[model samples]
Target chain A: MSFSIDQILRGDIPRVERPPAADPSLVPVRLRVNGQDHDLQLEPRVSLLDALREFIGLTGTKKGCNQGACGACTVLVEGERVNSCLTFAIMHQGKDITTIEGLGTPDALHPLQAAFIEHDGYQCGYCTPGQICSAVAMLKEVEHGDASHVTSDLMATDVQLTDEEIRERMSGNVCRCGAYLGIVDSIRAVYEQQKGQ
Target chain B: MRAFTYTQATDASAALHAALQNPEAKYIGGGTNLVDLMREEVERPNEVIDINALPFSQIEVLPDGGVRLGALARNSHTANHPLVRQRYPVLAQAMLSAASPQLRNLATNAGNLLQRTRCYYFYDTTAPCNKRQPGSGCAAIHGVNRIHAILGTSEQCIATHPSDMAVALAALEAVVQVQGANGTRRIAMEEFHRLPGDHPEQDTTLGRDELITSIDLPALPSTANSLYFKVRERPSFAFALVSVAAVLELEGEQIKNVRLALGGVAHKPWRARTAEEALLGKPATAENFRQAAEAELQTAIAYEHNAFKIELAKRTIVRALLTLAERQLLA
Candidate 1:
């Protein structure tokens, strides 16, 4: 019952491509997911989110709005953040991708995850995965001298992970359950801990 | 979404060749807008030519003290480029104030400029929208058009181009460079966009076969201070109800050069040419800005539900100019 972007667009079941039309049909795509390489055979239209959940069995990335409006499908592609639902599996053939699955495990939680646990960042927990992934990506983006809307000094040499900075950068992710306070607090805690470390 | 053939084009010529090969082929960049249209069943392409792998992702300085931004350069990358931040701060600020980080990361420079309108009727299949289905009859003409245009509109369409980045680019005199089947051509930023006069379906001046290669921006002088002021319902991830991109250069106490652009008020990113002409060499006072804005918007016509736009647009322009001039006075 999954939707292919083409089926919805065409309003019918799209004809399967001719064997020669797609070279190396459904070939295993090699991707560096979560700092590790993965080889998965997928249909040409499979999105990165589906490829991870169906092929690799990482269901941490939730699907709230299949469109990019809700950030439930956020992921890091080559150190930059992107909406995973809009990306094709084949397009990311040899690129590095980091999903919520790669962030941390139960046995060893990442600093952000620990902060969320400490500060209670989630109420319904549906948007937590996307929020955490977006948080992780924003941290790296800020460190790299990328400026946010609230970043007044565009040429600032050093970047501080301020609360306002994190909020502005992480505005893509939503907490529908109304856990914004705790979520921002969790991210701030992580930012403080990372600075201390 | 339906199943379609996907081809990755590694260069501009290859992209054009592939596009020419199929009438149903559509170029794909970040897929932020295209995928949304697909999910809504508004756009259907038999084959999608992926342009993400193309060599169109660089933002660099051009030879003549100008800036050259590639088509595939992500919004995040373009908004934060050092040269853009320094020379065209309004463009940088406008881009930063656009959709949030994740969406911006996946939206390209060209795609942002070429984005379709967010009109409700166009998105809703049941409603009659000329932009979505030309000659279907526009329901928004007398229907709910609070977000529709007030200038450069027609009986057929009143949809507005919804790009904060383009609004600022228009004021900066940015030029769009495209490669087509015939050859490469440069379109001035002001002419790149088209108003929804008789043809509501036509979006830009670009031909169907054209692929925008890069955007060229003229050198902005240091004293020509600029700012992008956006008035939205929310502080984040919301389209502007009214936005102003103003770049003004002052000589002592009088205006030397002025460029004013308005968003969310016109069918395209409207360059306030009339207002600019009126304000040049005049004292950079609040009253002069108000007069200039009024003269520019005198021809503006509003729909039933959006008449506030005329006044709102005027206020936005005056406020943005005054703020820029005030900063100088304080300094």
Candidate 2:
């Protein structure tokens, strides 16, 4: 707890700059993408959403607010959805990440993706990917018995998602195209399919 | 924002050591609150100590029939935890009623409690806010008094803590576990937040080097029934204008016990302790609840824009109490 001013002022420490953090061409950063290992070099302040789209070549995620206000930049990090835009690219090192591109493709669509296509869940398709990803995660959340604002019985042990549940759970995502009717229908369709309806 | 050095703490002790070494460092968990503050230029730390990966992510059952919540535990995970849902239903409700699914998933338990006020002036750097810049003067005092405090207001600051979960914890007598250079200490939930007084810049009584490790909540009586009610302009995902968390233990048709706490109207969650004194051993009637609600709000001094919160909170408390009283009959 004590230090001598004379010794501190001596300051015989070496100012050695050892090695570089990343390659000169690209900044080194680690990210777990689609259950796979991803190490990339990018700018220090790049957003997770933008880094995913530009550097990782995954464009399924859309950019709406760039801020945390909208859910357009939502993605699953360790099975939980978060706004990628609000997060830094470097923060997600070694964490399991699942994006909409990882959900499915045109050849083999995820259930939520297929449900959206079948239910005509989108118009102009701006918010569709984000909506599909959110629904996919939401169904899993409900299946795990997570409660929502409208989930009446917190004590039920087995929570059932009513329409109100779906609405409240998905309030973060805004469909500026007024495509919410179809979006809700698509989520309902997927829910019914998962329920064996 | 200028690039700051990144430091990741391997464990709790390491985190404490790092924090002690760098007094200008701030802990980063989920980056939900810190990132926005950085974006708004409200806070610019010289170093960010990433404590999200610390091994304190588990929610454990204390030996005394209580719960020990990890600091890094996200809001959604804690809200959905089995013990939280069963034993602390009000906490679950309050957590679920916070930000949307995405935000709740990323928001950590410690970050949520340590979050700064959402006052417009604090975020807008140009506006004068004593909390944001000490002695700058509070523009929010008269500029836009809406969404400000009523219970613990001072001329220097009028901001409110924006966590419904904190409100529930305040009512339940939660204890905050923090680690500092001198070691670990427990802070009572009620005292975790400081009232706006002569020093508006000091948000918490904690020293700059202290870091929250976890929050431990003592077990309430299992027979107690609780509920949370938030009055908002819109239905879902809006901040509470006035929220009430009430717990009632009824004996037959009469109220044997009552515990009340209110949010969105104070610097911290306002515990209706004085009001609860009046409701104990009273009949389970709307009149009793109305009286109790009025008794609690008697001390509230509201501003021009937020004066409506006084009435809205009264109605919220009454309805919350009556609703629980009715549910007690069925249980």
Candidate 3:
């Protein structure tokens, strides 16, 4: 029973049955995160961000804005970075999900993690996990010759990772403490080290 | 977010069947925009059909030198595809100029076209929005409308479609292939998006039961000379304040053919037909570009906080054309 706009404007609120209550049934969802598989029961409404923090107890991936505006919940799904807050956990059944916790540990830090420490890439550190996760994939994107908005030549096969390129590529993650300069330095340091190796 | 049952469809037929069975079902691709909208209560579907497993993730070049972009092709994949970057650089530039890298990674070609506006009043359920709740007053028409539409606006709605990719497609004259309950149909890029007339709620002419299969781009030899220029509050990761996607072909110093489309200016991608017509055979000069831009924006009606956009649009249009003309000359 659909009512037209004219009918609604005329104060004729269409008589329709109220939508059914939220489905409380917990659906079984299997997720592989940080090289581990976990089977759990979760509602379809649970986002990957919530599933990681609440159910799996992996709080490294922060949730700044759950509406996809902030990249605080960034995670690598199948090696491609995406905002975990914007996708449902139930949808990621067979994909390999990598969060900040999966990158490296404190003793054996990832090169980018060590570089971030060496360059002082954080102040408040609230957005660090997402920043590191984003950088992990962003470096891979550069290696694969992905173009950004600042990429002058689209046909060029080689991409020069300039400071401008890094800034443009990493624009998704925002640090409220304004650690952009240090973040740039850390990413560049890692990039140069990798090139040297 | 409202609880909804989720089901994965391995095939298009199963997806359509699921959608047909539930009148309140919505197909999900990447779930970038739809998930956020659902969380905000702007969109509430009782059933969510995951079409990610469907075989629509290919980006192939046709024999006619054109391109066919699968509906489920991720924005990043499409932008980085060799054919798209080499043949249609403007499209790749447009896609890159849009949302941040993370969003482009998750967003699909078809979902990008169907994304709703970033209208404040529409997202804020406390306020009145005709598009959100039909017959309700449009707060954007009188309230802070710095990001609202300046042309093709109705008294009931002033929201602009927020899609950088669609603007480029409009200029390229892309075709959207759709499959519905009846059969298959093709919709031109210009006619796919609808203007806010009496019914502000309807965003597109697509039937509720219809699903987008792919988008086909016609071969344009002059596409290599095209450019997509976007101006926003920031250099990156922001919607366009005024954007121009232009393809300029020149015979010596005279303009042979041109296509201009503007984003963040109207309900749909505003194809500057009047501007293109004015520059068909004219000398590619700054004065002529400005005149054509003026002719195209003559009917634009700017509101309180957006009167500056009218002039901004004119300047952007001229700058884009001039840049393209200069590039052509250098080539």
Candidate 4:
């Protein structure tokens, strides 16, 4: 007799124990994170944020809400910014994930990193890692002619990175410290510098 | 979250088979909403079928000039698609206004259609939410329900469908393509999501084993002048308190065709057919728009803390229609 999902969820039937064949729980996930290849043995429920922090010991990516609502756990997956907490570790096997640690070093900081420091783009600095990572991807998105909510012209291939566009693009990375003005200034400085190049 | 088995489905058939064979299996694409629910133990799937590797991720123009968005197509990609931006600007605006840049990158088209309600009581397991647990009773009936539904609500539940994309799709009359163990089928956009009647547990008309393959957007010239206007607490990355997706086709100063839908006011992306029926063949004036909004919201039943939504939705509808009308005149 077939059982409904509700019945199985309520534990009405015996839990299925895998035979000597395949154990689907312990998945083997290989990811290139921060220019480092990591072979991880994780469950399907293990989020990418947990894998980075607990398994790989990259604690720089802060876990703010552990949900997509707050972008505190933002990271770059295949050069596209995403919420690490919402994605499974096994789902990102072949993709390149760049975290805060992979961004830059103390000796030579990324332009955005330097700008953030110069403009004091943070206060408590708890959400700084996610903010920087998101901004890096945001800048790339704008450079690639991606449009935001404030984009008036959809036909224009070259999206002008106005202050409103930057704010709209960077809206995902929340700075609870009320450092929005500084963050905007920091992003603008780096954007202008990059344009000069 | 509870420990669960996982298998990556490389194709749509495999995904459907896995979900059909396994009683507590769920197909995950993006996992923005499901992951959050899993964390709260609201969803306890014994097995997860990863459908990200499936071939359903392309935005193709149909032979009939319609746009077919693959189920796995990410929201950001779909929103920025040239065809979508030009032909369905309302959809692009809705997608861009939803969630955040990060979420839009990960969230898929079909996943957005199946997103659950954002009711605080539903997420909190300790609270009695009929949507989460049938017959558990609805705590949001008297609890802090400022964000709860104001229309299509029942005595059992008062939860709102929180998807700006779905609201626009509702207005566009998009079709959902699905495949199940029984075979493939297409569901109308308005019929895909169900009202919160007696069975509050059932969100969509999709069967447990059915896999959403793609969403088909039929070519409609009038939809080009449509708009999706959202009023939320925050400017970005916030769920709507009241939003309207309105499309209008004008014959000089008269409304020839119209489609109106409301978000943050119902169990589903409510297609405001009453409003559309009221405005059709009428003058495209502010007074006419106001009257149509009132007609749609006539039967609205709001809770204690959510009575403001009734008025908010009405004003949003009028504002959205006016904005579309003004743009049409400018064009």
Best TM-score goes to which candidate? 3
Q: What is the interface RMSD of each candidate, in Å?
A: 6.8, 11.2, 6.8, 8.3
lDDT of 3: 0.91
C-alpha local distance difference test of each model: 0.86, 0.83, 0.91, 0.88
Candidate 1 lDDT over residue span B1-331, tens digit each: 6567788888888988999989888888888888778666678787889988888888888889899999999998899888888888899999999998998998999999989998877876667888889889998887778888999899999899999999999999999999888898999999989999888898899998899999999998878899999988788888888899999888888999989999998879999999999999999999999999999999999888889989999999999999999987676
Output the chain A TM-score of model 4: 0.86
CAPRI-style docking class of model 3 based on DockQ: acceptable
Q: What is the TM-score of chain B alone in each candidate?
A: 0.98, 0.97, 0.99, 0.98
Recovered native contacts, candidate 2 = 0.60
TM-score (second chain) of model 1 = 0.98
Model 3 C-alpha lDDT per residue in residues A1-197, reported as the tens digit of each score: 43444553353532232343555879999999999998989988889999999999999999887777779899999999999999999999999999999999999999989988999999999999999999999999999998999999999868899999999999999998999999999999999998899
Tens-digit per-residue lDDT, B193-287, candidate 4: 99989999999999987888999999997434888999998788889999899889898888989998898899999999999999989988999
Candidate 3 regions off by >4 Å?
Answer: A1-23, B222-224
Chain A TM-score values, per prediction = 0.81, 0.82, 0.88, 0.86
Give per-residue lDDT, candidate 3, residue B194: 92
**CAPRI band of model 2?**
acceptable
Q: Give the per-residue lDDT digits (tens) of candidate 2, residues B85-196.
A: 8998899999999888998998999888888888877876757899999999998787666788888789898898888999898888899998887888999988898888
Tens digit of per-residue lDDT, candidate 2, span A1-197: 22233432342222222243353334588898998777897655567898899889888899876667678888988777888987878788888889998999789999888887887888888878778778888888988888887788887757677777888999988787888877888898888878995
Model with the higher TM-score, candidate 1 or 3: 3
* RMSD vs true structure, all candidates: 4.8, 9.2, 5.5, 6.1
Q: Candidate 1 or 2, higher DockQ?
A: 1
Off by more than 4 A, model 4: A1-25, B222-224
